[model samples]
Target: MKLNYSVYLVTDREMAGECNLADIVVAAVSGGVSCVQIREKNLPTRQFVEEARGLVEHLRPLGIPLIVNDRVDVALACDADGVHLGQNDMHIKDARSLLGGQKIIGISAESLADARRAELEGADYIGISPVFATATKTDIAKPLGLGGVRIIRDNVQLPLVGIGGISAANAADVIQHGADGVAVVSAIIAAESPEASARELLQQVTSAKRIV
Candidate 1:
């Protein structure tokens, strides 16, 4: 599949407030979100699997790829498009061995070395975590400002997706710094109008890519 990381949505149930995850995701996709990652850190395994399956029903026909966060089992259970892993999660090689080479595997990188390692280990893409400090995920490593992004971009050829504190106001800068896309949490999840927020962010990313 040709992945368009342009506007990536990382789901956060708490940040979503009263809105259902399916509704937010459906709305966001309609507004131009190119990818979706379902991240459930505390939910039970069964529930996570069910949630992912539910999303698959919504996204499959739309041609959107649904990635399960941190759980190869859940992805397998739901037959998701792929899985995104953090450094502490399962190793990429093991994940690839289990998920097989056909599924997409994304890794989170907090430094240049991490990005390099991910590339060597066969990650399909690299998510540059905490491009700016973010409240959505407190345990993440130090923010990798735009400078970190540029340095990593210089070292790796894999697709880069900037995460943490990304919003319309700075989405352009993230792309200009060399990210192939931006992965966002509350920026779209917590918005009053997810469609509008997604539209605005996608516009910023698309415009910046043209310049890059």
Candidate 2:
């Protein structure tokens, strides 16, 4: 998948305040978000499928991909572009058999071992989680820090996306440390202006990539 991972947005409806999820996504994509992942942890299966289907309609027109988080079934139901899997989620081999080779499959790696295994298992990309401590997800591992990103980059050839506690302020640093992009949650979703926030984040990642 020749994806431009810069300025990745992971959704959190709870943090969106009064903004509608699709509305926030439209505004963010208009600003510069390259990718959007629908991550509904508590929503029922039917609602999750409905939400993914809705976002796919919004994103497809803009040429942006909508990734369904940790739910291959939901992705299949919605005809989403891809699915993001946690380290403990379904085996990549099994996921591939079901989704086929056309769909993108991203694996979250909390450790070097996890990253290596994902690559060996044929994951399309690697999501480096908790690059810094984050309140967004209560059950994440310890922060990997910038050094951890460099370590994973050194070992893996796939694209790297740094998630957890990422914002415009540190997005450039994350890219400099070797991430192809930053997967942000509250930084964009909770902002007063999701468009402006996404614009700033894309700018940061773009500039850093130029330097790297």
lDDT of each: 0.95, 0.94
Cα deviation in Å at residue 123, candidate 1?
0.5
Candidate 1, residues 110-205, lDDT tens digits: the string is: 999999999999999999988999988888899999999999999999999999989999999999999999999888899999999999999999
In model 1, which runs have C-alpha deviations exceeding 4 angstroms? none
Q: Against the hidden reference, what TM-scores do the models get? A: 0.98, 0.98
Off-target runs (Cα >4 Å) in candidate 2 are: none
Model 2 C-alpha lDDT per residue in residues 86-193, reported as the tens digit of each score: 977899999999999999999999999999999999999999988998999999999999999999999999999999999999999999999999999999999999
The positional error of residue 105 in candidate 1, measured at the CA in angstroms, is 0.3
